[model samples]
Target: MQKILGLFLFGIVLLTNIEAKDYEIKMLDMDKKGHTMVFDPPFLQIQPGDTITFIPTHKSHFAQSKVIPDGAEHFLSPLDQKTTFQLNQEGVYLYVCPPHQMMNMVGIIQVGKAVNMQEIRSALPKLERKAMTNKGRFLEYAKQIQE
Candidate 1:
């Protein structure tokens, strides 16, 4: 009976240790081209167990998950609405706008540790593909040009 009780207590501690951080992602004014896309801070730095809230003032904008080089579905926002998602692991999350991918309406969420832009740049192909698929042909061409 004592052993069972000890195991139960250990489980409780493990559960308590898992916590998530919350982030508020806001979309502000558009650029010169009148793109209704935006992301607060543009880039976010956070640790593991963090959450990001995407609040878009404009109803037409959307967020969606991008495709990582490893064939993973990175966090993506919905189009024309507000959304939120929690970061459960430590890694680089690349997100972009479904409508303004060409304008580079992109954002990054770094969790667990620090990630340099160079690392993210190296994996541009995958990111570009993911962006182009959601945004449009213009963004696809734009991503290729950057590389």
Candidate 2:
């Protein structure tokens, strides 16, 4: 009976430790309604161990990391394919679609905290004109996270 109780407690512990959740962001094309080639929910906040899946609902879209936290890994998804990235660090991550970068197809992810705000801010000026337009949105989201 004691052994069974121990096993049950272990199972409960394992379940409690698994806190990761999956989030989906869809890539959409420019349209008459002024969609402007963007990622739905361009900014997201998640915890370490959570995963984000970038889905290309429209053609010719992909996700590539443009800025990442120090000591964090960068990733690029294949064009027109769905890709998943796991956030393991407590900082900010910025990504963009290569072909539509000039059109400002961008996104920001905050994992646990905005620890890499300075790094992300410094990298914004390196982006092209259209891509820089998304900077305002990113900053707004970052501010929310900090608050």
Candidate 3:
């Protein structure tokens, strides 16, 4: 009876577990929207514990974390390589493609909630300072966040 009860409890645990979701962002030379050196779906909203896979559909573009909530780790994937990021922090994340950031090749990710949006807001000017063109795109993406 004890062994049977343990097995039953294990089954219950498994059944109640919430599985993390997965998402993908493609690195493209140019998207249908006419943005160049950009990540497809440049704006994303995900719950905590979700995973984002950045796929380099075109060579020479990579994803690198630019700004994140305090204590969140920064990441940089090799150029033209695929990388996956497991986001457990409940805040905003800003990522960019180094070579093309000047072209406004950037992305925004809001995890769970924009907990640190205020902090990110303060840094937006610096982030956009590198964009030779399309600097206003940052504000455009920022506004997309409902919070």
Candidate 4:
């Protein structure tokens, strides 16, 4: 009887885990040339009920939204150490760094779908455009993060 009860408890735990989804974002450091960039895990996709944890192993890093084409929801970590952003949408997200925009520090997030490499690649230019234009709103958002 004890063996049967243990098996049932294990089954419940497994089922609970399947229902919860989680993801991670690692902000990488500068290369030999001192260019800070966001290392691509290539693709990070999740369902609506999922979370994305942005872990910056160093200072001077945060995440922001791409406004023009994708109009992705934005979230930035204050200069206060580590931060996490839980995703609650069902659309594609394109993000970039403000200070290092010229260096092409970009990333993509696709929610409720399998990893699509081409889709992510296509969105890269939008991020570049926003970075180059130094658009008022976007840059302001970054400044807020630093503040």
For model 1, the superposed segments whose C-alpha errors exceed 4 Å read 1-19, 31-36, 67-73, 114-119, 125-147
Q: Give the alpha carbon lDDT tens digit for every residue of 1-147 in model 1.
A: 999999999998787566555788776556444544556556676666667888886566666656332323466666656777867665666676667666456666666553333556665565555543224422333332222
lDDT digits (tens) for residues 60-102 of candidate 2: 9999998888888998999999999888988988888889887
lDDT of 3 by residue, 49-88 (tens): 7889989899889888989988788878888778888888
CA RMSD for every model? 7.4, 3.0, 2.3, 9.1
Q: Rate the local accuracy (lDDT) of all candidates.
A: 0.60, 0.80, 0.87, 0.57
What does the lDDT come to for candidate 3? 0.87
Worst 10 residues of 2 by lDDT: 132-141
Residue pairs clashing in model 2 are none
Which tens-of-lDDT digit does each residue in 1-147 have in candidate 4? 999999999999998678767676667665444545643342465666577777776567776766322333577766524666766665656676566566566665666642333554465545556554323322222222211
- Winning candidate number (lDDT): 3
TM-score of every candidate relative to the true structure: 0.60, 0.82, 0.88, 0.59
User: Residue 89's C-alpha lDDT in candidate 3?
Assistant: 83
Q: State the lDDT at 116 in candidate 3.
A: 90
Residue 26 displacement in candidate 3 (angstroms) = 0.5
Q: List candidate 3 stretches off by more than 4 Å.
A: 1-18
